[model samples]
Target: MAGGGVAGHGASAGETKLPPLTPGPYRRRLGFVALVATFGGLLFGYDTSVINGAGGFMARPDQLDLSPLGLGVAASALVYAAVIGAFTGGRISDAWGRKRTIAVLAVMFIIGVAVVSIAPSLAVVVVGRVVLGLAVGAAAVVVPVFLAELAPYEIRGSLAGRNEMMIVTGQLVAIIMNAIIGNVWGDQYPWVWRIMFALAAIPAILLLLGVSRMPESPRWLADKGRDDEALEILESMRPPGRAKPELDDIIHTREIEKQRVSEDIGKIFHNKNLVRIILVGCGIGFFQQTTGINSILYYGSDVLEEAGFGTGGALIANIAPAAISVITALIALQMMDRVSRRKTFLVGYALVAFSHVLIGTADVVLPDGGAAKPYVLLILIVFFVGSMQLFLNIATWVTLSEIFPQKIRAFGMGLAVAVLWMTNGFLTLFFPTIIAAIGISGSFFAFAALNVIAFFFFLKNVPETKGHTLEELEEHVTDGSIFHSIGRK
Candidate 1:
C-alpha cells in the first residue's frame, strides 16, 4: 500500500505514528464528482423542506381541508415510505451496484415530484410523497457511502460531508422559493403549493443526466473481483503513482474477509465486532432525531405559529434556521478535517441541550401574545438549529458511512438509517399532537433532557474515523480496538 504522511518531529521518540495523508492530487475531479452525486442530497433536502412551507397551504379549506390527524398523516407519508426505501435501497445497491441504483433513484425522484405537483386530491399527493420518499431514503443511504469510498482518507470527512451540506442547501432553496411563491401568488391562486413541489424536478433531471457520466465506486469494483477495472478507476482519481498499491491493498483485504465470513446481512449479528458497529450506527441515528431537530425542520412554521407568529410572519421567520443551517454546514465542512469527531459531537450536544432548556424556560416565563415572546422564541430556535448544524447533522452522516466494513456496508447502513427514518416518521406523525398536548415549553424541555442522555452515549461508544482511509479504518473496527479511542489507529 502507498505510505501515509510522516509523523511530526514534535512527537515523542517512543511513540509510533504513521504520517497523515495530504489531500492534493485529483482535487478538481473529485470535487466535480462529489458535486454531481450530492444532487441526490439536494433533492433530498428540497423534497423534505418543501413540506415545511407547503403543508399549511395544502391543509387550507380551499385545498385539502385536512384535519390535524389528516395533516399528520399527509406530512408523515413520505417519511414512512422512506423507512422501506432505506432498507430496500441498501440491498439494491449491493446487488445492482451503486451508480446504476442512484440513476434509478433519480428517475424515481422526477416521477414522484411530478405526481405531487399535479395531484387533484390529498390521496394522490400522499401517493406521490410515498414515491418521493423512496428516492430520498435511497439517496440518504447511498450518496454518503459512494462519496466515502471515492474520497481519499485525508479529505474523506469533507467530501462525504458534502451530501449533508447539499441537503441543507436544498432546504434553504425550498424555504426561499416558498416565500417567493407565497408572496407572488397569495390566496388568489390555489395552485401555488403545486409550484413549490414541481420546482424539485429540475434538479432531479440534472442528477439523472450527470450521474450517467460519472465513474462507479472503485471499492465496489474491487470487491466484485474486477481488480483491473477498479485499478483503472482508482488511477484516474488517486494521486500519481498510488493506484496500484491501493488496488493491491483492497484486493488483499477482500481476500482476508472472504476467508472469515460469508457476505450476509444475518452475519452482522453473529459477530461481536460487527454487532458493536451496527449498534453505534443505530445509536447515533436515533439520538440525532430524538434531539427534536426535525421537529423544527419538518414543522418549524408550526412551532413559530404556536409561539405566536401569524402564518405569514412564521413563514418568513422560518427561513432564518434554514439560512443558519447552510452557513453552519459549510463551517462544519471546513472544520471537519481539523477537529476530532467526538469533540465536535460533544460540543454540539451541550449547545443543543442548553438551547432546549432556555427555549422551554422562556416559553414558560414570557407572557403569550406579547410582541417580545415570538421573537425571543425564534432567536432560541435559531441557536438550537445552528448548534445542530455545526456539529451533529453532517458529523453523524459521515461517521455512519465510515464505521461499517465494506462487506456489510450497504446492509448495515441500511439497517441504521431504517431506524433513523422510522424514528423521524414517528415524530413527524405526532409532533402537532405533541405540541397541542404539551405546548412548545414542555416539548423542548423533553428534547433537552434527551440530548443530555445523547451526550453520554456518544462519549462512551462512538469511534474516531477522521484521518484514515476506509480500508485502514476497517482493520481497527473488525478487531474491536477502535471503540472509545481518540483519533488513534
Candidate 2:
C-alpha cells in the first residue's frame, strides 16, 4: 500500500502493492539470521547423506550385519520418521513460534546423533535415525518459512533459497568427510562410520546456540496480534520507512484471510482455491523428488560401484556430483531473485529428464567392466545433479515457502513437505532393491518418465511468483487468479 507499482509479469490492476527493496541499516542482521537458520539445512544434508558412505561399513558382518533390504530399512528409517516430523512440525511452529521450534529441533538433532553414534545394534541405530529424521523433517518445513517471512520481498527468493544451498553444502561436506574417514581409517576400524555420524552434532549445537539469540518470525508475531513486538523485529530487518508499511500490509492480509477462512485446518478443504494451491504445492514437492536427486545423494557410492568403481574409488567419486551441487546451488541463489519460478521449474524438469535418459542410454551402450563406463556415468550424474540444484531444488523450496497465505502457511508447508519427505523416504527405502533388480539404466529410465510428467505438470499448473510479495500472492491465490497468470508474459 505504501510502495511503487509491481514491476514483474502477472501483475494486474488493484493487486496488493509492494514496498521498494530497501534493506537499510539492519541488512547485516538479516544476513546473520539467514546464515544461522540454514544450519538446519546443513544438518539435514549431513544427516541424510553421511549414510551414503557409512552404510557400506555398517553392513559388514561385524558391524550392523545388515542384508541389502535391512540396509535399505536402516538407511530409510530417519526418512520415514521425517514424514511424521514434516506433518507435525508446521503445526508446532505455528503454535510454538518458528525460532523456538527450530531450537527444539536442534536439541533433537544432538540427541539423535548421540544415539546413532553409540548404538550397539541396528535397532538402536534406527531408533536414533528416527529421532534425527523428525528433526530433519521439521527443519525442512520451518527453516524456509522462517526465512521467507523475515526476508524483504525483493530478495526473499535468494534469502529463502539459501537453505537449499546450505542443504547441498551439507551434502558436499558429508561426502568429503565420508571419503576421508572411510578410505583412511576404514581398514583398521570397522566402526569409523560412527565418527561420521557424530560430526553432525557440532552443527546442531551451533544451531541451538544461534537460534536461542534470534528473534521470532515477525509475521508469526503479527498473526498472533503482537503488533508492537512484530514491528520491532521487522524494523530490525527492514528499512526505517518500510517496516511499518510492511507490517500494515501483513496485518491487512491476515484480517482478510481470517474473514474468509476459519482458523480450522479442515476449513481448507472447503475453499476450492486453497485446495488447488495445496495440491500444486504437493505436486512441486512430488516432482522435485521424482527426479531421483536424493537417490544419488543418499547412495552415490553404491551407484558408482554399480557403474564399475571399486569401493575406495566409488567413495572418492561420490564427491563429484555433490561438489557440483554446491557450485550450481550458488548460481541458483543469484538466479532466484531474477528468474521466473515457473520457467525455472520447467527448465529444471526438462534437463533432469534428459540427463536421466542419457544416463540410461550410456549404461546400456557402454560395455560392462569397461574403463569408460563409470566415468561416463559419473559425468551424466554430475549433469543431472547440477540441473536439479540449479533449477528445481531451490525453486521448489522457495515456492513452497512463499505461496501459502499467512493463516495457513505453516499447515500448507507442513502437508506439502510431508509429501516431499514421504516420496524421498520411499525412494531411499527401496532404491537399493530397485537398483539391484533393474540396474541403474532401468531405474533412471523410470525417473526420466516421471520427470517428463513433471515437466508438463509445471507448464500447466504452476504460476510465476517472481516479483510478488507474500500478501500480494495471497490475494491472487485465495481468489484462484494466480493460475490465470500462467504462460502470461
TM-score of each: 0.95, 0.97
Q: Which candidate is the best by lDDT?
A: 2
Worst 10 residues of 1 by lDDT: 1-10
TM-score of structure candidate 1: 0.95
Off by over 4 Å in 2: 1-19
Candidate 1 per-residue C-alpha lDDT over 1-489 given as tens digits, one digit per residue, 9 for 90 to 100: 112222133332113323333465578889889999999999999998898888888888888887888888877999989888998898889888899999999999999998999988889999999999998998999999999988777788999999999999999999888877886685788668999999999999999999977889999999898888898888888877667756656666677678765787676678898898889999998999998988899899899999999988888999999999999999999988889898999999999999999999999999999999999999999999999999999999999999988898998888889899999999999999999999999999999999999999988888887776676667667877677374442
Model 1: per-residue Cα lDDT at residue 463: 86
lDDT of each: 0.87, 0.91
Best candidate according to TM-score: 2
Over the stretch 231-279, how does candidate 2's per-residue lDDT look in tens digits?
9998888876777867877777777678998769888899999999999
Question: What's model 2's overall lDDT?
Answer: 0.91
